[model samples]
Target: MKHLTYFIIFFSSINLFGQVNYSGFIDKYPIELSADINTSGNSYGVYVYTAYDDPIVLEGNLQKGKLIFFEKNSKGNKSASMTFEKFNLDSESIEGIWKDLKNGKELKITLSKKNEIGDGIIQKTSIGDRYFRIVADDQNVSEIKIFQKKTDKLIQKLKVDCQFRGVHCISTGDYNFDGITDFSIFESSYAGPNTSSLYFLYNPKTKKYFESGFSGTSLEFDAKRKRIIETNQCCAGSSVTTAEYKVIKNKMILEKERCFKWSEKKQELIERKVSECR
Candidate 1:
C-alpha cells in the first residue's frame, strides 16, 4: 500500500512474453510499473515492473520504448496498474495520441542506437498531449515529428535540418521571448575537454530558424515569447532532463529542473495544456 519508484534492471532472466527481461524487485513487494516499449521491429516488449522508484536501467541494444506495469496477489487478483509511455516519435503516432490520454506524463528519453544515446524532446502540450521531437545527425535529416497522443497517428511533422541531434524532449510553446512557439533543439557533439557545443534555433521570422549558441545536446525550453535557454548535460548520471522555458520581453531563457513532486496531482493533467502546440 506504499508508493516506491523502482528502476528497471535487466538480466538474462527468464523471458515471459518475449523481449529483454528488464525486471527487478523493488524495495516494496508487489509494486508494478506500467511502461510502453517500441522498437525498430513490429514486435515490442512491455516491462511490468513491481516498483516505480529509483531508475529504469536499460543496457545492450535499446530502442525507443516505454514501460507499463501491474500488480496481483498470490491468488491471481489484480491490484493497480500504470503505464509510463516515454519515447520520441512523430506527433501523429499511436504513442503520440496516448500521450494526450488521461493520466499522461511529461517526461523525456534519450533515443539510442545500440550504446549511443540520442537526445529527445518531451513537453506538456496545451491539451495534455506530449510534444516530442529529435533532430537528426546533420542537415540532411528531414521532418521533425511531434506525438499528438499515445495512440493517435502523427498529426504534425515539420521538415527541418538534421544538423542537431537534439529536439528529443523540448516544448514548442514559445519558450523564448519570441511571439510564436518556435521549435528548439540541443546538439552536444563535443565531449573532449571542459566545453560542450550548444545551439538554439527559432522560427519566429519567415525562413529564419538559426539561433545563436554552441552545438551539443541539451535540455530545451520554450516560454512562448521570452528567450531560448539551453542546458547542456543537465547532470551527471541523469537519465533524462526537463527543460524549463519562460518569456520576459524578447529574450528566451531555459533552465533544467527536477520534476514536480506531483505523485497523484499529475494524474489530473487536463487536455487544455496540449491544445494547440502543434
Candidate 2:
C-alpha cells in the first residue's frame, strides 16, 4: 500500500491590475460562475455550474475589462456563450452585464468572493495517534490527508477522483480491529444504479493508513464482531448478495457470503451460498 499527498488550491487572488477572480451566482439564474481574469495575459478561465450537469469550463480572452467565453457540449457543438462587459472589481459589489449569445438574452450579473467552505467541505477525524482531514467537493471527495495532531506534521495525502453525491459523504470508525479508526467514502457507478466504496484502514504498526482492497455498496462496520458486512442488489432486484469480512494480518478476508434470488414459481426468496469475494 502507498500513502500519497496531493494538494489543489481552488481559489486565487488578484495580483495584477484589471485582473479579477470572482465566484458567485449569476443574477436571476440558477447557475454559478467562477471566473478568473488575467489582464496581463489577456486570457481567462471561466467555470459555469448547474445542478443537473457537471461544471463546464470555458476559455477566452479579456479586452478592456470585457470577458467573452464559449462552451461546447459533449457532442462538440457550441452549446452556449457568455459575454461579461464592464467587469469592475473596485465597486462594493462586482456587477456587470452578461450577454447570452445563443439565446440573445442579456442579464444583470453580480459576483462576490466565494466562501472557503462553499464549494469544498472539510471534516476532521482521528485514528489512534494520527489525525486526518477529509475534503469533499460537489462531485466527490477531493482528498484525504493524515497529520500528527501534536506536531501538525502532515504524514500523507491521497487525491481521490471518485464521483459521489454530496448527501452521504464519508464516515470514520474502527472497522479492522486494529484499535485505530478507519475511513470510508462511497463512489457511485456512472453506468448503473450501483455504488462502490473505498476503505482506508489504519495500520498501527506502520503508523500509516493503507487502502483496503475491499469495496462494496452498502457497508456496515461491526465494531463488536470486528467485521464488515456489505449487501448489494444484483440483476435489478431479482437477486441480492451479502458478504462478511474480517481483518486478518492487515488484510480483509471474506468469512462468509450468502445470496438470495426471487423464485418465480415458489413466490419466495431462494437462498444460495456464494464463493465470490469483491
Candidate 3:
C-alpha cells in the first residue's frame, strides 16, 4: 500500500481521515489503505488505477472501500491475508460523461497478491472557470472506487445530470493565471431539488468550450492573464444572490453586482461578489 486511491465521503462533520479543501479546485492524493491478518484467503479489497483515456469519475460511498478483518492462519489454513488498496492521480480526468478514501498506518502480509499504483494532480484551475466533482450510489457503498482506482468500469457516469447520488464531481484550480487546468463544479441535489452548477468547460488557450453562471455552485479560473473566480451556492434557500463576472476583452463584465464578502484569502463558505469584465 504505497498510497494511491480511496475516497469515502460522509461529512456528518467529516473526520476519520483528513484533508477537505472545497472551493474551486481540490486535488489531494496520498490515497492509501492497509490491512493484513493472513491465513490464506489472501485478503483483498482494492482500488488502484492509471489507464487514463476517460474513466476518472468517482464520487459515491465517497467512492467506495471496505477492508474489514481477515482470519484463518496459524495453520488453520485460512488466515493468510492481503488487503492493500491504493489510488492517487498525480494530485488528478474524465470528459465524456463525467462523475467522480483510506487508512491504517500499516499491517503488511505480502503474499504476491500484490497491489499498488500511481497518478496525481487532478485539480488547479482558471479561465471562465468551473470544475467540481463527486459521485456515489454503489460499489457496496464503500468497497472502493475513487476515480479510476482499478476499473469496476465507470468513467464520468453521473446520470440525472448530476442530481446527487451522494457527492458528485468537478472542482480544480488555476483561476485564469494560466498554468492550465480548470473544470469547476460542485453539486448536491439531496434528492429533492438541492441545486448546484458551475461549468466553464476547458479552454486552455483557444482550446474551446465556455459557459459560466446561472446557479454556478462553485467556480475558479486563471489562464495566465485571463482570470475568473466564482462561488454561487443555493440548495433551496431564499433569494440568495452574490454576483461577479469577468471576461474583459471578450465580454462578461459585471464588475460587481450583488454584495457579500469574507475572502480572508479565499476561505469562503457563502456570501460572494467579486467582478471584472472586458
Candidate 4:
C-alpha cells in the first residue's frame, strides 16, 4: 500500500554479530530485513514493516541454495514462513514466496541488498551538478561515485570503511570552512554522545574530495568563528573534555582545551584544567 522511501535498521544481537541489511517489498508493502546465516546454515535476524515499525523475530536455515525462514510473533508463535528458492546472499536482488502458515495464503517476496547510508537523497545541492552515489556492500564497505550530471560520466570513486545504514550514517558540511561544501561518513560511536566520522574535504584544484585525516569526538564546526570543537565524556560522564581547534592549511591545530570534573556535592561541572598551545 504505502511505499516508504526511508527505513530504520533495528540493531540487535544479529547486527552486532554481523548481519547484512536488506530492503525490498513483500507484496508491494515496504519491508526491511536484517539476516545472516552461519556456516552450519543457521539464519537469524529481524524483519519489520516500514509502516508499522514492529519487529518480528526471524530464524531459520539455508539449505541447498534455498533459504527457508520463519517469522515469529511477540508471543513466540510462528506467523509465516518464506522460501527463497535461489537464495544467494551476494545477489543484487532476490525473489521468493511467502506463506502464511495459518491462513495458507501466499505473497510474492522481493528483496535486495541495502545500503545503510546512501539512498540518492542528497542530489539537489551544489554538488548535484554531479550525480553522486554511495553504495554499501555486504562487508560494511561503501563506494562513493561522483558522475557528471550532463554526460553521465563518472568523476571519482572511493572505497570507505563504514557501518550501519540510514540517515545518520552520512552527512555533508564544510568542515574546513571552505566556500565549497564537503561531506563525511559515519565510522563509529561510543557511549554517551561520543562519536566519530571519516571526513572528505573538497579540493578545488583537483575538483575532487580527498579524505582528510581529521578526526575528533563529537565534533562541531563554527563557521562564523572559524573554529572546530570536540566534546568528549568518560568515567560514566563524570569527566569531560572540550578541545578547540583552528583549521590551518586543511589541518586542525589545537588552540585551547578545558577539562571538567563532575561535582557530586554541588551537582555541577567543575573546571579542573585549562591549557593553550605553547
The segments of candidate 2 whose C-alpha lies over 4 angstroms from its true place after superposition are: 1-120, 124-138, 147-155, 189-194, 273-278
Candidate-wise lDDT, in order: 0.32, 0.57, 0.31, 0.70
The positional error of residue 171 in candidate 4, measured at the CA in angstroms, is 1.3
Error of 2 at 184 (Å): 1.5
TM-score of each: 0.27, 0.48, 0.25, 0.55
The candidate scoring highest on lDDT is 4
Q: What is the per-residue lDDT of model 3 for residues 20-111, given as tens digits with 9 covering 90 to 100? A: 21111112222222121123322222211223222222211222332233323335443323222332212221101111102223332222
List clash counts for every candidate, in order: 91, 2, 100, 2
Per-residue lDDT, model 1, residue 242, is 31
Q: Give the TM-score of candidate 3.
A: 0.25
What RMSD does each model have against the real structure?
A: 18.5, 16.1, 19.0, 12.4
Candidate 1 structure quality by residue, lDDT tens digits, 16-50: 22222222232223221122232432222222222
Cα error of candidate 1 at position 198, Å: 8.9
lDDT of 4 by residue, 129-210 (tens): 5544456554354676666644546688878877644323446888999877898877876776677888989888998999
- Over the stretch 1-278, how does candidate 2's per-residue lDDT look in tens digits? 12112121232322334323355555665444444455464443444333322345565666787767666666776666666676555644466555565677776666775445432322222444454444655445777666554454678887776653332345677767777677876655522234567787777678677888776666788888889887666555556677798878767788888776666776555665454312
Which stretches of candidate 3 lie above 4 Å from their native place? 1-49, 56-182, 185-241, 244-246, 250-252, 259-278
Model 1 — which ten-residue stretch has the worst lDDT?
91-100
Better of 1 and 4 by TM-score: 4
Misplaced by over 4 Å in model 1 are: 1-130, 133-142, 150-154, 161-174, 178-183, 192-278
